[model samples]
Target: MEDLVLNWDLGTGGLLLLAVAAVAVLLVLIMAFKVHAFLALMVTSIGTALAAGIPPNRLVEALGFGFNPTLGNVMLLVALGAMLGRMIEASGGAHVLSERMIQLFGERRAGLALSVASLLMGFPIFFDAGLVVMMPIIYAVARRVGGSFLSIALPSAVAFSAMHIFSPPHPGPVAASATVGADVGLVLVTGLVFALIIWGTVAPVASRLIGARIDVPVPDILGDEDEKTGFESRPKVSTIILLLLLPLVLILLNTALNTVASTTSDPDAFKATPWVAILRALGETPIALLITVFASMFVLGWGAGKSGTLVEKIADSALGPICSVVLVTGAGGMFGGVLRATGIGDAVAESLNGIGLPVIVAAFLISQIVRLAQGSATVALTTAASLMAGVVAAGDYNQMQVVALVMAMSAGSVGFSHVNDSGFWLVSRFFGMSMKQTLGSWTLIQGAMAIVGFVLSLILWAVASAL
Candidate 1:
């Protein structure tokens, strides 16, 4: 989180061009030269940093500092979530859940059912973790229902991305709301409304339209070709649901209590209570996931009649496949970090600061630019909010207007996820999608979500301004 302390003498125009060139080179390296994504990202990061005038001594430190933080944030979640997912997959729990869903919703409506489930689950879990845990079930449903994987996967993926970008307890929106001094409750409520509306309406239509063009066969997660043994003794549906919901319920409780405590007259009194402190600690994301993983060991593994040794092997096996995912995601973060070190995001936002545009529109546009430049939505949102905060504070705005602007910034933060973005790789690798397929499907989904969310926010801002 420490800002790179180098002096950047480039103007906004110069830095913006540099950002474009960096991304173009990255694409060429990956798409044309066939460089491994990890090496390409590292090369681009170092080259970009040097091009942007980063001192040589600070170069390695800058890249490591950027790479390490992202790696730290993601590694535990990916590893633990993967273990939990593997347990569910190996024990026939995912098959059970998918079967039940297909029966209730019917094969034709399976995609809708999965998406709704993902929306509910996405409220609490981070996008990558939620997607990882849900993948087995998604795969099972796709196998049973017999259709393009995109028909099922895109809707569910959009749901997670929508919730993660817009809602609180997911860090990005929470931090942006705080920076802009918007009411957290208002932002949370507004975000949920807009996100759900878009997820229900825009995302499905977009998914169907795009899914047809991208033909991705489901990858072999459950070893479908040789899985008769595990499927013979499937776990109960109720147990599978409980295992999935446990962490979500705990995390939601933590968010609710913290919101209440923050709003109360004596915040410290709530924090000082032994039970509150303990629950908060337990509900911290890694702990919540850990608790869920342990519980899953019982509910989805041993209780399902698998041996402890088998469970250990399943969890251990999960780590091997995702090692590449973790490193490439970290390198993606490193690229973003190098861009940040060169002060590109700040320069663009600063240049956009005073152009007499509507505050909400400005927020969306600035956030979108920063997002395209850097590839981390959280960084884009927080940096844009910081740049725009003074203006929002000084303007004559009503409560809902403030909320709408926060939503606008949140929406813009999700703009156009591409090669430089880590989430791009996460989706591409997990779903067995190629780069062109990822662009046509995942990238386009993000663009649709961002634009639709922004449009909704614009309407809200206009209505609130009128009032």
Candidate 2:
């Protein structure tokens, strides 16, 4: 279902109070009381809904509205992406890629290479999924190079986080663009420019400064020891790279065609062409991933000389671990959804209009508020965009400015990931960092990236307006 259709009866003060209470209770449950994230989120959602005066009968509907859609969008990607990653890792492709990267970039630049690779892979994969897929390589590189886990891990994780937040085909910016009526092509283009600038300039610096202060031990979550089993039979680096790039190429082609088709004078011109339609379908995110998974089965499985049953077992193993990640993420979405159902985000966005800030700045602040209140960046993005849609319509922003606004909203959505965020836990568990260590590293990295992204977006907005 779409975000809750709410005609909020509560005034701004009441809604704000409820939102603060809900977030407080959620944090207390998870951080202080040590409750499982899913149960805590459910109880808090139900309590907050009642306190916010959502009718008792509609409470379940509201929870389901938030939970199911998030589960639907995320599960397929996470599951399939994990499967592909498992196959790659199990087949020793991760080792091959890391070794090749170290050779090409040398040891000093290996971390940079991994970050760049993650930036590319992040184009098609979600942040968590991309991080999972790259974990083996990060571990391999760290082991070979001999350094702090943060040195190798932070850059790659931050790269994925930046791309996921600031670019399209990752839900946040795409939904934000749609909500605010920004051109998706323009947003994608401008978002890419800003994303690269932000990640390239900011993430590495943060890795050196912040990551140096925090020490984290890399965990063997990806079954790295088993990688040696098929080391000699691993697929070539080119083959692994091809598998990784397949979805991105398809998705980009689809984006390019849709942009061209939308601009055509005759709307039906592209639709009349069967080949164009088919290509677009293939470019769809889910379809692109499905095709990539099947291709991987042949390339990484049979082509690599692994038996069919072995490949099946490998993929099966990938799913069991990610069940918590998927559920916690969905629960984070549920909390954000319940907040939306109460119209708290809307109230805050509406309040921002009289604050004398630029709309782009206002958009960023609103998104950050929603993000901090709830735990899901996607939820923060959509809720913030929904609230800003009316303001954006009235502002008459130019195309570039509109794109910048979308990026700003995206930046805000990813601003601060703390206790309530499933992503926080995922990073902590996967990288084997304590909660405090994660706060110092992953949380700091995301916060720094978000601030840098917003600043860059503001600069872009200024330049665009001046032109």
lDDT to native, each model: 0.85, 0.78
**Residue 415 CA displacement from its true place in model 1, Å:** 1.0
Candidate 1 lDDT over residue span 243-326, tens digit each: 888888888888878987998899989978999999888877788889999998887677767787877777787888888888
- Candidate 1 has its poorest 10 consecutive residues by lDDT at 223-232
Give lDDT: candidate 1, residue 160: 92
Residue 263's lDDT within candidate 1 is 80
Instruction: Record all residue pairs in model 2 with backbone atoms less than 3 Å apart, i.e. clashing.
Output: none
Which residue pairs overlap in candidate 1's backbone? none
The C-alpha local distance difference test score for the whole of candidate 2 amounts to: 0.78
lDDT of 2 at 390: 85
List, residue by residue over 237-314, the lDDT tens digit for candidate 2: 899889888887888888778768878987578756899989988987778878988898888887767787877877
Q: List residue ranges in candidate 2 displaced over 4 A.
A: 1-10, 124-129, 168-189, 227-232, 266-273, 356-360, 375-404, 419-429, 434-436, 464-467
User: Cα deviation in Å at residue 455, candidate 2?
Assistant: 2.5
